[model samples]
Every structure is written in structure tokens, then in C-alpha cells.
Target: MPITEVFKEEMGIGGVLGLLWFQRSWPKYSCQFIEMCLMVTADHGPAVSGAHNTIISARAGKDLVSSLSSGLLTFGDWFGGALDAAAKMFSKAFDSGIISMEFVNKMKKEGKLIMGIGHRVKSINNPDMRVEILKDCQTAFPRHLAARLFTGSGEDHHFKEAKSYPECERFHWRRICGHA
Candidate 1:
């Protein structure tokens, strides 16, 4: 592959990956944020299924690419994509003016569990160190839905709307149903 000037070898991995993902050279702060994410998740995640799959593939004598692909293919709603679903829900609730407590209660009433609220292994007492480390830097990188609504540039485009939920206009049905 021809290496363009924008994605030169001299640039950090985060900057190169960010350019590929976001299609632009992110600011220094954004690159740092991505690097922090990479650092936190760079360790061997023994508990997650993806890591397990990768290990199994390597043990079975699969090549590096195959092993990595095996792990990446395991990502879905339960694991790697949980945050994505949460972002959508957060954006929907914010746009609809549905308070966070109300949104949680409504989801409960409908028998739908909230994504990214809990973990398969980690709990309140036994928290993931990576998550704790990231949480410690939350002030530097405010990713709350309300924060995104105000700072249009900082937000990821995927968090702009909820695919599962219709537009806010259809929210009237929810109000009607609550009264029933």
C-alpha cells in the first residue's frame, strides 16, 4: 500500500488509525484520547470472549492474522458493541427530553435491560482497573450525551441517533401508554 503524507510512518498509531476511522487528522488532544483508550485496552483481557478466541486460535496453530480475525469476529452486542448501544440510548433519551431516571424506569417497565450498565465478571466491588483508570480521566474527556449535544465537534457521528427508536415525534405514544 502506498503511504500518503497524511498517514506517514512518523505519526503515532493513534493518529494513523484516527485518520482512517474519522477520515481526518485529529487534534493533539483527540489523538491523546485515542492513545489512552489503546493503552487501557492493550492488555490481555482474560475475561472477555474475544481474547479467549484469539488465544484458542493461536494454540490451534493459526497464523497471526487468523488469530486476530477470530478475536475481532467475536465482538457483538454483548461485548465490544455494548458502548455503542448505550450511546444510542443516551442520545435518544437526551433528544426526547426523557430524564435518565425516567429512561431507566421505562426500559425496566418494558422488560428491556440497559446495555453497558453491568459486566459479565466485573462488579461494583471488583471493578475493572481499565474502566477505573478511564473514569479517572473523565473530566479531561467528557463523553456524556449532554456534553455531546453541546459540543457538536467532539461527538462521534454514530451517537447522533438511535436506530432502534423512532424520531422524538413518535414519543407521544410513550406518554399515552404511561397514562394508560
Candidate 2:
């Protein structure tokens, strides 16, 4: 088969992100969700570490490639590194059958700080609008239906087992983003 034909067969026209498009059975909103995620995380502002580093490097007469590399290098533990830690922590807690309150208690007891649970300016009363936008999109999408179904008895054994955790119901991305 021709490479183009093979590409079409395997990935379809919108298969630039293999993971998102891997399953032909995915809901239509799946692509939209991926896009929303990308949009939200694309950039915070020039004050952020990566952008600041890039600006500094450029002002120092660095080339575009070097400046970009310097910016990316700033994305370690102190900068834009909390997402991976948060994902792992949440996954571990969920897999271990821990509730949200219990997880919070354990982290507190261990003197471990939750990575994605605070913002410099946003508070519970005044949440970030970007998070609100993403939450609204999620609610409108069919994936919200799937999330609901996943909270109950579903054919997906993993989800079915996970439904027992009350945290799963309350744990929205908005909450996490707002917490930070």
C-alpha cells in the first residue's frame, strides 16, 4: 500500500495526535478536548519562567535555537514541572482507593505540598476564567456524558472499579486549576 493510503488508514485526516485519534470509536469531542487542553497550556505570559528565559537569552544576543532551548530548559521542578507530579500523585492515590479528603490528609501528614493547588491571585471566591472556560467546554461535550457514565457502572472495568472513589466525582480539572 502507498504511504499516503497507509497514513489515511491508520490515522485519518485529523490524526496528528496519535493518542487522541488512535481509537476510531472516540467521541467527536475528544478532538475538541485535546484542542482545549493545548490552548489552555500554550502560554501563561511573558512573566512566566520559560518566556522570561527566552527574552533574557534573546537580549543577550543568543540565536533563536539557543534562546528556545534556554527557555525549554527552565521548565524543571520549580517552573512548569508540576503537571507531571500532580498526574502521578493523583493517579497513585486513585489507584490505591483513597478518597480526596484522605489523600489531602495524607499529604498534610507527610508534609508534602500539593503541586497544583494554589494560585498567586485567584481564590475560591474569584476563580480563574480560563479554567471556567475549559469546564464549560467539558460540560457541553459528550465526554461529560462518558464521565457521568464512568462514575456509575460501565463496561470499562477500570472505570467501574474507580467509581467507588467519591473523589472521582468531585475532581474536575477546574477545581485543580483553580486550586493552583
lDDT of 2: 0.62
- Error (Å) of candidate 2 at residue 79 is 5.0
Off by over 4 Å in 2: 1-15, 19-25, 45-127, 143-180
Query: What residue runs in model 1 are displaced by over 4 Å at the alpha carbon?
Result: 1-10, 45-128, 142-180
TM-scores, all candidates, are: 0.34, 0.33
Question: Candidate 1, TM-score vs. the true structure?
Answer: 0.34
Best by TM-score: 1
* lDDT (0 to 1) per candidate: 0.65, 0.62
lDDT by residue for model 2 (41-137), tens: 6556433788788979999999999999999988866677677678888999999999999999999999787767786357788887788887687
Count backbone clashes in candidate 1. 0
Model 2 CA lDDT for position 121: 54
